[model samples]
Target: MGMIKDAQVSVRDLFRWRQRTVTVDEQGNEHVTFETPSTPPNPIRLLRSISMLGWGAYLIGFFCWTADAFDFHALSIQTVKLSQHFGISRTEISTAVTLTLLLRSVGAAIFGIFSDYFGRKYPLTVNMWILGALQVGSIYAPSWNTFLAIRALFGLGMGGVYGAAAGMALENIPVEARGLMSGIFQQGYSFGYVLAACTNLGVGGATSSWPIMFWVGAAMSFAAGFARLIFPESKQFIEARQNSKGSSTAQFAKNFGKMLKLEWKVCVYSIILMSWFNWFSHTSQDSYTTFMLVGKELNNAAASRASILMKTGAVVGGTFVGYFSQWLGRRRAMIIACFMVCCLIPAWILPETESGLEGGGFMLQFFVQGAWGVVPVYLSEISPPAFRAIFVGLTYQLGNAISAPSTQIINALSDSHTIRNHTGRVVAAYGPVMGIATAIIAVGLALTAAVGPEKKGASFESAAAATTAEAVTDISAAAAPSKAHQSSSVGQATSEEDLAGKKGANGDSHAVLTKTEYA
Candidate 1:
């Protein structure tokens, strides 16, 4: 019971969002401290800190995530065509998507654990290859069951790629660069959606068969896999593997178990936070188009145009807001975006005319996804080093799994409610339901972010190093007050190094500071 209390207190303290201090020394070199919130580096210095090697890794990871989005949007965009092919209702066809979301947790657990135990490179390579193959198989599926089977398999592969790619991209880069790059990297999802929309507009319009779009996605996945192969293992992963060379198998297991036992509280809290975020995104995005057409009585062309505009807004908001997270702090940026979304709900839902609805959708998604832009970096910062991939990926996918039925839930809730359209036809009041749900979710997002922790520039070296540091601190603290002070100072230095974005020996001096450091 005492251990449990300690764990709870540690988690509460670690995640309680606090400001950090950024200071520049006499040599014009900047240092980051956790005293309080202050000035961040200027745009020019931040830009200068970006290295060619870091950018290369980031670009590769970006495209990989982009391809993941492409494949996902392929199914989302072609729901009507798929229903026609399978001779099923649109709701029945939507089961495939729900199943994919639920099953991604299985993939995240599988690949995330593997990436932590082994390295990010091979697992990610295999993930891309499998994703490509699954898309190809999807093209040849003989029946609805077969199509769903392929997608389920595709979900497993899709589940693993994000964690591995995020680890590679963000972990290998200099800490200072992570904030800006996280925004750019995460926008790969929105960019992929935009690309998929264009492809469907062109290719889906031209071909009677939906398989061609799958074929295109498969090709893109193959290209992403090839690109990953050209780049070697990330510096962070290689260093981690090297550091674990002398440890016996049993010791490794013991260390991992200990870390998990200690950090379980934080893990649970993270899952809750991620669940709200997933609900916020899936609820707002997946059903808005349907609501616009059915409830608002917009023409098909107008609805499509509004959707495109919404996605365009997502792209801009995601990139710009992601970059802003570095300056504003992750939680603050997220709350601000969510608040803007909450405020815009009236404009977004109450509009009866096409132009009003279109403009509202654009602005709504701008803020909705702008908050999302911080997710990758925010999750990365809070994650454990040895299990960075697993912790972030598992929590994220589990949240998604929990929210798998969001669309169905919203649909059911809105079915009985009706509103008089401009033409006086009584349609289901999807707009009201969506507006209320989204508003509630926005509040939840803000509260969760408010209470949660921020490791704005935490280290990403490896989990093993963190465990070792924690052990040392525990021993030293028990020995003498002076030694405990020295140990605390060391932990503080690690944070400074993590936040200051000083170039390490390999030009990517990433290190793992233990969770106890934060506590």
Candidate 2:
């Protein structure tokens, strides 16, 4: 009931224009105040603030991310065909998905840190190339063991893409436009799903034709990588480099250690939040095509069409909710979307006719991915300025790792359960199982979001500048006492003691600072 009311208020807030003002107090604490606005900022003018180079970086990032999604979904949407081709149960094929998700965290940790220290260009380009090559490699795998090995390798490449792509895409955009752009950027995943479904529809359901989709995925990956090669590094990254002292292995390690020590709570919270979100998406979408085919008794063509429609809804919902989040607030947007999903569950999975199933699938995914659309910017806002790429990628992929078994769990449970099909034959109860799982996940996600921290409208550039200034101040302070002693020995000792106390006080303040106040 409380959730329903919040959802209502969230919807109402979308239509009401409001102005948010940030004020800093004497202690440097920020207070946010909101009021009714007579006129809102022009959306078109807001968009024009992004430079041509910013658009290029965003597009390349979106394309690379889309290509990665295409490669992964190609296998997932073709689960039945792959199962037949490999002469294994659908449950066994799901193991490959599990393995892929399980290894993503490893890649995220490696490539995320590398991207943070060096730049997004080299690490992201290499990851895309690796993904393309692996997509091709999967087509020629002789045995199930070899196939799983390729998929596990694919996860590593896939994991690196999200952090690099998200950082490059969102970092340079104006804060006012980030919500809308984030929505559009996150739709790359949904668009990739749509593309995979279209490809499946074109190639037909023959087990032999699965290789064609892989070929297409490989081509897309390579194309995205090549496109990125022509673009310069992200503007924010370039500015950050200019203002910093220098990057090195030792400096990076020290920074990373300090971040972990000071920001461990945020890190843990993000991982938990991401874990729920990953499960929400995976459990709802991964086996959806299979559910349509077996549970609804739809033909491959109908199932593929329905899958396309479902993801189309995801694209639209993500965009709308993402834009709305700018005014409604990130946490509110997510909470509302999650509660809405709970209401749509019955429609999502219980419909008997193809059109009914289509409508249900579309509406459910609309809200599901709508919540997801806020994720990129929300994660970016809370991330430490210097380690945006690594922090965003590692937390997200670690959550992916935690929820890696969603598909397998769904398949295994559904296989064990039975239901009567239209033909009156007992079949895996995919629909009911998925519906129940989605409801639980949606509720869990909503509750988690309700209690979580938000750093909406945080300024990344300012944070970076503050960090640099603080470092410089520390250096100057350390060197000051050595230059001259203008006091007696007793006075010097007292001044030294006071300085130590001040340092301790500053350390405590730094330790307690929120992600938005990191500097």
Candidate 3:
């Protein structure tokens, strides 16, 4: 245990962890005798540090995820119209949403493993292609059954996209930029909402043919998929492929089994954390419009305006908070976001009119999703390099599946309570209950993120010996050789000689080394 801090610890054990003390020599060189993770570049400089290739890779993944979000909300926004077309109740149409959420875990498992075992490129390309086809197919559905059937397949295809895209973008980039890029990447969902909303506005709402919207979604997905082909396979994945002992299906299965045996605790904790995260999002969002329409007596126009404002805020907040997490640390930023949401509860729920509610609702989502913006990168960093794609995607979708009924729960709670409006008519109490439930979910999210372990500035490369050597080299590079030589009692380590020798001795070891800087 020369460096116990580098070893992955359980979520339950993270609280027991102690901070390493930094000691400075007489020459003003720093040393950490205990284990500590590396630090990325400053948040402002993070973007400038990445190469153009990194930005291109990130944009490709960003739009792919955005398109995925666009396709999903395409159906959701049309649920009322779809219900009317099928001569079914709104509640019945919700079956499709439930199916999409539940079956996403299936897609994540299949695609996650496939992407991890194969390469990130081809599987993701196929996933996007199938997703586009499904969107088109949904347009021509002859009956309710056909629509639902197409959606089930869509769910599976949709599930695979995030892991593949995230792995492609995140694994290829320089580690220092990952924190800042994570925020931009995750807002693809909010950006998708904005795009879908624009499409809805352009097409003229419910009166416009819903099929037109589906066609738009189909085109976006196809375009995003094909766009990914323009980029090369991720470098991390290429390295992983080279390091892999076997390429056969049997070998893949064995490696997967081994990954599970080694990282089961991480897996379980990830799922639990994701579950609360999903609930926090869905419960706060799905019912807010209903609260406006029912509880505050907002007109259709007002409710729509508030929703648009909320999503816009989500896009802005998600990116901003995500970037800030690089400086603030992931757990601290998330906890701050959660508390900020709690503070916004009053304006969010207490307002009696649309004008009052709109600002609060918009600001509320800003903080909520701002915290969410950290999720993809945070999860990737914590996961074993060999299974990053599978672990992050599977855990996220499983959380979505578990929280699939959050909207229903809110609706049920709302239905159970009755209150008189200004008109003196009894209606479900949506505002007060929603506020209470959201506040509770916010607390859960903060606690979960606080307890979770972070791997800030961890190496994405999976090759053990080379990875360790690389970490040390990176630290030395940051220190500046002449400065480090003058400062440390130990001799200056050169990348070619000292680092390479250490690589052979610790070929199987994997640890992100602590930083050492000379003043």
Candidate 4:
């Protein structure tokens, strides 16, 4: 068929398949591309629908972040209470907090892999339940070991939720909203932190009423997870599933292989950025200022309040960054955020007299911390659609893996200075070193971000086209019947556009459909 006549067929095919690729299941042991179809889009309605999904995913991020804030610190305060009850030393009780963060990274990794294989919805829902369960159960644990072990297990749920959520966030939002949504997604951590601090203060004092904190997390997780379960799966993941078949967990491994073959750039990006983003966010949000303020003679209430202010800044920065980055594009927004990091971090160490002084405590806690809204947006924009769930999980967990151990080390190292009260003295002692370390980390990230940054509010298909087009063609070909034809070039053609006339699952015609590699 010629271009014009084929265009009409393509339009109908587009509507029929909705730009989702089609494949064939060959006895569960093998697969082949049945056909490739032209991009299908109800651009107007699709955009709106996707935007709604973005919002829903954003809510997921919000809920997860809030839960983490509640749960992440579960060990910190609970260790104090449980230690008194169980007669364990403060250091020994510390395992509850430490292990939780550490173990959650495993959750993120495993669940992330599951999300890739099973799709994002189920894993996401399950993770929420885990969080809620831990909150409810941890309140009444009989032994210190059991309490700590369960709390650590909760981290796994926390780990799995976001990367999958990140996948959904990208799919649900339109190309235009990618940057903003990314910011919104990433902002969850900071917002969650703020939510935690405020919740702690609101729900009776932690000193007398630490158990209330767990109750609050449980309640929120239940409500949100319940509401969230009704939300739709990421169209991206759904589309991918429909194009392939057979529910065996082994397919998960196969899909990862496809992902590796198709989108290695994204994988590289995930690994590289994961370290910086995860470590810095974890270190700063979970520990630093609280430790410093406590060391400097600040009361728990005052320190908690300071944490609230800082995390609130992060929330605000993220919420605003989401929309703002939509206008600016992901890379530029990230560049701006990177510059902000460079600017905000050095204040951590300056002498009180030398430091800007008046709001230095607040600045370190909130402003510097608040600048974290950059990561989600970047990751969301960069990932491949087919492999999103898996990649997000992998990259995010990879980051967490690096951060989890590092946070523990930071805790161990900083434990010596013991910032019980005075905020000033604490900043004087540890703030500068942390600030420098963070800045160095930021600069290193800035270098890798040299991938010329993505433009905001453009066609996602086009953005991913160059990277994914060939893989799409190959995967489609693999599922095709013997009739599928290729350009007779062994990828020596230098461009995917050269290949033509491929049929996909429903026997649709498309320009990109050549032949599946396995087919």
Each prediction's TM-score against the native? 0.83, 0.85, 0.80, 0.70
lDDT of 3 by residue, 105-138 (tens): 9999999887876677778888898999999999
Q: Which segments of model 2 are wrong by more than 4 Å?
A: 1-42, 463-519
Off by over 4 Å in 3: 1-44, 243-245, 294-300, 422-425, 464-519
Between 1 and 4, whose lDDT is larger?
1
lDDT (C-alpha, whole model) for all candidates: 0.72, 0.79, 0.70, 0.54
* Order of models, best lDDT first: 2, 1, 3, 4
Model 2 / residue 215 / CA error / Å: 0.5
RMSD to native for every prediction? Answer: 6.5, 8.8, 9.0, 10.5
User: lDDT tens string, model 1, 1-519?
Assistant: 533433343334334344443332222122334443446656567667878878788888898999988898788666656767888865676677788888888999899877876677788888888899999998888898999888888888888988888887887667776777787777788788777767765663322657877888999899999998888887766655565444444544565676577556567777888888888877887767667767876654566567777788888888778888887788788889999999999998888887888788789888888988898988887665566788888988898888888776776676667888777899988888899999999998787776565567765542443233332233223223343244543222243234446444534333333223222
The clash count of every prediction, one per candidate, is: 5, 0, 0, 35
Please estimate how well model 3 matches the true structure, expressed as its whole-model Cα lDDT. 0.70
- Who wins the lDDT comparison? 2
The CA root-mean-square deviation of candidate 2, after full C-alpha superposition on the true structure, stands at 8.8
Q: Candidate 3's error at 114, in angstroms?
A: 1.5
Q: Tens-digit lDDT track for model 4 on 1-519?
A: 232332233223222322222222222112222133333333345446554556666676566655655666655533344556678655566556566656666787688777766666777777787788888888888777778777777777777777776666565566544544555566666666666667665654444576777787788777667766887776655554555445454544554566576445446556766776666666555555444343444445555666666666666666555555444433444545666767766454443332232245445434333335656655554454445555666677767666666555554555554332233343323453456566776677555554422313322332111123333443444334343333343221112233234544565443332222110
- TM-score (C-alpha, index-matched) for candidate 3: 0.80
Per-residue accuracy of model 2 over 291-375 as CA lDDT, tens digit each: 9888877999999999999999999999888988887778788999998999999888877888888899899999999999999
